[model samples]
Target: MNARALGLLLGYGADRLLGDPQRGHPVAGFGTWALACERQLYAPSRTRGTCFVVVTTAPWVGLAVLATHLPASRTLVTAAFTWAALGGRSLEREALPVHELLFEGELEGARQRIRSLVGRDTSALEAPDLARAVVESLAENQSDAVAATLVWGALAGSPGIVLHRCVNTLDAMVGHRSERYADFGWAAARLDDVLNWLPARVSLLATAAVVGATDGTSAARRVLTGASRDGARHPSPNAGPVEAAAAYALGVQLGGLTTYGDRVEDRGQLGDGRPVSVRDIRRAATLTRQVGLVVLGAAVTATAMGGRLRRR
Candidate 1:
């Protein structure tokens, strides 16, 4: 494999083995910068949001561009980006803790742990309901946080990964529909959706493939079809497919009544199996890891093919 692929592979290993470093997380730093920008630039308009995105993303993009040019810096830069941007380890850390807390019958602990994983209100959730929420978040984010990074890292090395993370960060920070940010966050939300579009579909197939590998199925299409039905109910164009696949794969149902800060959203339903359980939390993390492996494998294959094409 080429340096880029090698770097990504190493980076994946680092994230899997080490998660993220305890201090100086690049995303956290970017978060601070982004919040500051938003404070100074916030308005109920798209123009200001657009400007916020540009201002926040420009520095990272420029540094990535510079990093790509130095042959000596390529491996280190790619590895660094992979470590920082891809969130498989972080996702696992956040996810499995809920299962642990739940398994111990610590509903209060589980609720708090669940909060670390999703934006929804966890205060009143029963054990099963909380498990469903964790599974849903893990599955959806498996695409957004893990698979998408690998995809973008393979496509454009550090620059692609960096920019994608920036977009995703913006969405998490400002893309929600609060009264203060409804219109202002519109652009950020849409950009995140568009960037995530292909990756989310890829995530569905990846999840289905994992299911097929273990279930003795030959055709992915059949599994995908069932998963598709599950995904169709979600409001997000991208999250629906992956979360639906997770629900199907995990033998559980997700989506029902979800509470945020104060509002309750009835997001219909997905899947048709057992109710959520603590085990599904571990299952969801395992599934995301498997998908991450698949994404990395694809990246390696693509890098190898690109090398051959260049020779041709």
Candidate 2:
């Protein structure tokens, strides 16, 4: 209704229509710079990493502020920024190929296809594990790619969204468990976790609400149970809720016993029964879209309600 909500809608519509930049998204540019910075500034301690996080991400906030000065270009900038921040179509585009490969019973093809989506060793993954990983990624990325961005876009407009994207890109570039980056990536990883914290919960609730509407399941109990039983096993505070809710939504078990690197560990189960499948992967993709829509809808309502109250 208002310009802000309309701008946000147009931005999300852009994602649905345009997907990602085929060649040069701004986030890609940031990623390249971040990698260069890591190579030049990396140290075996957290202090440098902490400073790197701030130094690298702070400029985007400034850029965002500068963009605000061009009132004539405000809507265009916001729409473009939010479009870049949201990745609904690309997320499904990546996930579906894995499903198609798995559905064709081309296990090797599926493995190769999945590499584009996840960083995990696919050599050992069976079809089910591959599907499970896709579903998990879809859920977590729903938080990171859609909900987190939309939340920030609504709360602080373009600058906040840009800043959040910068932090996320930094984490992707350097955050990991490897010795070279374990210490140096601490700040990037932690900041990403902090930013995604509330958004992750919102994503989980959005996912579980969809499931409840479709299956008559109790969104609260299932989400809570899945979170409690399986959440503790996950390494991320934010990822746990998103992945757990997705598992419950699909009525499929995820996590369980799995191999990671050189270690084999039981991550326990998240949902009720059965391993994930191609069908579940499709469902997860649909659920990802639903979650994004829910976030957008909520934002519109909140903005409209706030505007009304302000007038009163």
Candidate 3:
């Protein structure tokens, strides 16, 4: 019932659910539902206008009712489901397949796979571009999927987490500037921007804390300052800080030319480190895991303190 116990349960449950084919992979279900809802609810113009009001309003009302009557175990189960559902497919393992394809000199194959995971073109990308894309995706997703869900779950329980995931899922499915989604995805995009506002900064701070702890306090301070100045330069509002911090912590350069379908987007670079490489991608993953652990620990601690205060 306490935050720490709840956070541990949620975190442990997420790890256990990973690679679980029997449940059809938990994150996949979340993505499926989200995509389905967007296709159904927003694809129609009349419905799209009311999407935000409907989605946000319904969940809080439902959660209020559930909180009043639901048993603790049931609430926890719901929370666990929300965590897995929001994460989508396990990109952590999926990244390895991409690495292997690139490792074998399968440029075409790697590019094809990369298309599914990112909005950019991988066909013309060299090794450094490929590595940068992977690292960027990993860093951004750490805030969007992992850190955001975990923090919401700890603070507000299952329904709160589920609501956050729904916003995120909707954004991913329909939120883009492409002609097909421009109007319909507007609500989802705005909502995602609002939801991610705090979590994004929290994620950057968490990354800085971990880097400082692992490297040194001075290194952490430099990374934080770099992120504060350079993070906003990235196209996404929330992704900049985490990516900037990671680039600084790992001593790698990120951001450059990114090709989308037929257009190329040249983003400003974040860190002053070396160009990306395969080793950098792997190191980024390692750093992601390390930050995840630290965030989990902090969530648990905060939850414990809350329980004590309530008892008093």
Candidate 4:
């Protein structure tokens, strides 16, 4: 394997084993700095939003570019960047506790724990709604945190990986329909959509492959068919496909009345299967892990093949 592939695989292993560092994570630091920048840069204008994105994200990308250029430390630098960017294990860690809380019949505890995973109002959510929220967040975040990070890393090396993660962070921070962000967050939201476009489809494909391997072709076909039919209907262009695919792959319906703060959204159903229950939470987590492994394998194979072809 070349430096890129080897670094990515090692970083992936590190993530699987150690997960993200508990304190002073690079991503967290970036978010803090970005928030400060946003305080100064926030304006109800798309142009200002564009500038905020460039100002906050460019430095990290440039630093990544510089870091990867050190021949002596190239692999180590790349691995570090990959490890910092990917959050597959952290995503699962945040999600499974909600499952555990539900399994123990602690509805209030589950609701409180789920707040870490979703932005929705969990206080009033019952068991089924809580399960749906966990499943949806898992499916969508699998694409955002795992698929997109790997795809950008494979395509553009360290800088690409950093850039994707930075843009995604900005989107999550301010990308919303609220009055405060509707205009100011346009650039981050659109760029995230563009950056995530391929990754989301890759996520769907990964879901299909994993489901097919585990549950046979019919289930895989359901994932694809459901996504094709209902994916575009959701507000987010990228999230819809992956979430829909995951819903069908797990044989559970998702997307319904979701409350975010005072905003109420009736996201139409995705799959035709039964309403998601507490049990499907673990199933979804397993499916996400399998999908991530599939993505990792594909990324490694592609990077390795490309490396060989370039040599030829």
Per-residue lDDT of candidate 4, residues 170-224 (tens digit):
9999889889999999999999999999999999999999989978998788889
On lDDT, the stronger of 2 and 4 is 4
Instruction: Report, for every candidate in turn, its global Cα lDDT versus the true structure.
Output: 0.84, 0.82, 0.71, 0.91
Which segments of candidate 2 are over 4 A away from where they belong? 217-220, 257-260, 263-266, 307-312
**Cα displacement (Å) at residue 114, model 1:** 1.8
List clash counts for every candidate, in order.
Answer: 0, 0, 0, 0
For model 1, the local distance difference test gives 0.84
Tell me how candidate 2 scores on lDDT.
Answer: 0.82
TM per prediction: 0.96, 0.93, 0.87, 0.98
Clashes of 2: 0
Give one digit per residue, the lDDT tens place, for model 3 in 1-312: 564456455654666365335466644565665565555565535357357436544654375347535565654564455445444236566566677787888877877887756777676887778878988988888788777776776676566666777677667767777777777777777878888877788788888998888789999899999998888888888888888988998999887767778766766788999988877767787788777667666766776777788899
TM-score of candidate 3 relative to the true fold: 0.87
Best candidate, lDDT-wise? Answer: 4
Ranked candidates, highest lDDT first: 4, 1, 2, 3
lDDT tens readout by residue for model 2, 1-312: 655566678899999998999998989888887877777787889999998888788787898889877866667787888998888899899999889988889999998988877767789888888998899889888999999988887777788789888998888877877777799899999999998987887787777777677766766567667766777677678887688788877778877665657656565667776878778999889889998898888876776676677778
Query: Which window of 10 residues has the lowest lDDT sum in candidate 3?
Result: 80-89
Steric clash pairs (candidate 4): none
Encode model 1's per-residue lDDT on 1-312: one tens digit a residue: 777888888888888889888899999999999999999999999999988889999999899999889867577888989999878888888888888888989999888877778999888888988888888888888888888888888888898899899999999999988888788888889989998988888788887788888885744555588678867777888888888788777778887777778777776687777788878788788888898787788877897688678878
The 10 consecutive residues of candidate 2 with the worst lDDT sum are: 258-267
